[model samples]
Target: MNRRMAVPEQPLLRVRNVSKIYGRSCGECMEGTGPERESNICPKCGSIVAGGPISFDVYPGEILCIVGESGSGKSTLIKSLYFDDTFSSGEVYLQNYEEGKTNLLALSSQKKRRVRNCLMGMVYQNPQLGLRLDFTSGGNNAEKLLTADWHHVGKIRERAQELLARTEIPIERMDDCPKNFSGGMQQRVQISKALANNPSLLLLDEVTTGLDVSVQARVLDLIRQIQRTLGITMIVVCHDFSVIRMLTNRTLVMKNGRVVEAGLTDQILEDPQHEYSQILINSML
Candidate 1:
C-alpha cells in the first residue's frame, strides 16, 4: 500500500496597493534612473501619477502568473515587490505584515539589496544580463552563493558544479562563460544561480523569451519539475498566454497597469471576462 505525503500550507508574501511615482512638479519624488521622467501627480487634476496602485498575494507552493503586454506594468509590479523602485502610495507586506513583519517598501538600501539577491531570486528575460560575461558559468553561479557565507570555499565550488549537473548542463563545460553558451544553455545556468540559496520566492521575468520553441518547452518543464520538488512560490511574468497556461494554476491579466481579469487557469482560458483577455486567448490559439 502507498501512503500520500502531507503538504505544508502557509502564506508566503503579499502586495497591498503598491504605487510608485517618478518625477514631481516640486522635485519631491524619488529620483533615479527609470523614475526620472514621469510626474508624481497630475499638476492639473491632482491625481496620482506614475506607477499604479497594484495589489496581489503569493501563496506557498503556488505559481502565480502575472500576464500582460508591453508597458502594461507587469515589470513594474515585480520591481516594486523586490524593492528595486520606490512606491508613492500603499504598502507591500511580506510574510505576516500585521505582526510588524519586514516592510518590503521600507527597507534600507543595503538591506533591500540583501533581501533581493538572497531571500528572493530574480531571473531576467536575457540570461546574459544576469550573468557575468567575464566569468565562467561555474564562477558566475558561485558568486550568487557568496551571500550564503559558506566558509568552505571548496565546498561551495563543488556545490555550484553539482547545480550545473542537476540542471542538465554538463559540469565539464562549467568553465565556459555565458557568452560561449547558447541561449538555452545560458538560461539553465541563470536558473541554477537563481536557486543558489534556495529562495522562497522566485521571480521569473520572461525568462524563456529568446529561446527556440523546443527550448522553451524544455525550460518550462524543467521549471515545473523544480518547483514541484522544492515547493517554491513563483511569479512568472510573461506575454505569451500558452506559457502561463502550461505552468501556472492561477492567472492575473493586466492591462494599462491594472488587473482586468484573474481566476483559475482553466476558467480564464475557457471563458474570459475582459476583452483584452479574450484577445489574448484568441492569439494563443
Candidate 2:
C-alpha cells in the first residue's frame, strides 16, 4: 500500500497591531446657551480616539471570517491588509516566493502594487465598483491581460467563460454588460474577474450584503465551494453569523472596533466567553 505524505501548512498571511484613524474631528461648539456639542472623542472615553489594531493569521487553504457590525473595523482591517489605506501602526507579513515571510507594510508602493494583483484577489462590497460597468463581462475579465504577460485574448476569453460557468452564470451572458444583469449576477461576474488572477489568497468584504436573502445563501454556498475547489486561503468580512458558520471553521468577533473573541466557530457560537460576544449572540436570537 502506498502512503500519501502529509502536507505542511505555511502561514500565508499574518497581521499584527494594524490600525487606521480618520483625521476628522468634531468642530467647536456653538453658543454656550445651547447644549455642549457632542465631542467626537473616543466613545470609550474622552481620550483621543486611537483607531483599533487587528491581529490574526490566515493559514493555507483556510477560511477566516472577520465578523462585526458596521464601523466595527471589519472593512478597515481588510483595506489595510490590502494596502488600500495607510496603516498607522503594525505589520503585515506575507509568504514570499523565496519561502520566507515578508512584511507587506515594509514594501514600497510599486512592490505593493505588484504583490496586490498577483498574490492576492479582493472582492469589494460593490461588484460594479470593482469592474468597468461600460465594458462587457468578457471584456472586463480580459482587461487584466493588459497588465500581465498573457496578452492572448483567446485564452482570457476561455478562462473567463470557465470562471463564469464556475459561478453558475451562463457563458452566453459573456457579451452582456454588468449593468444589464441583476445584482446577484453582477456579483458573480465580479467573482469571475477576481479569479482571473488565480491568486493564492482572496479577500472578500461583505460581498453578499446587498443581495436578497435567497441570493445571499446562493452566493455564500458558491464561495464555500470555490474555496474548497481552488484551495485558496480566504479572509471574509461579514456581519451575518449564518454565512460565517456555513463557510468558516474559525471566526473573529469584533465590537466597537476591537476584537472581543477569537476561536473555533462552534466554540465562539456555543460558549462565547466575552461580554460583547455574549450580547451579540443573545441579540442574534
Best by TM-score: 2
- Where is model 2 more than 4 Å wrong at Cα? 1-9, 24-40, 43-51
- Report the poorest 10 consecutive residues by lDDT, candidate 1: 29-38
Per-candidate TM-scores read: 0.85, 0.86
Clash tally, candidates in order: 0, 0
- Judged by whole-model lDDT over C-alpha atoms, candidate 1 comes out at 0.75
Off by over 4 Å in 1: 1-10, 25-50, 96-100
Candidate 1 per-residue C-alpha lDDT over 1-285 given as tens digits, one digit per residue, 9 for 90 to 100: 001123235457877777665444344322311222323344544443444556767777788888877766787777667675667777666563344376667777876777776778878898866788779988887888887665577988898998788778898888888888888988998998888878878989998897899999889988988887888889999888788778887788876556778887778888998888898778877
Cα distance off (Å), candidate 2, residue 101: 2.8
Scored by CA lDDT, what does every candidate get? 0.75, 0.74
Clashing pairs in 2: none
- lDDT for residue 126 in candidate 2, whole number 0-100: 92
Query: Candidate 2: deviation at residue 119, Å?
Result: 1.1
Task: At residue 28, give the lDDT of candidate 1.
Answer: 35
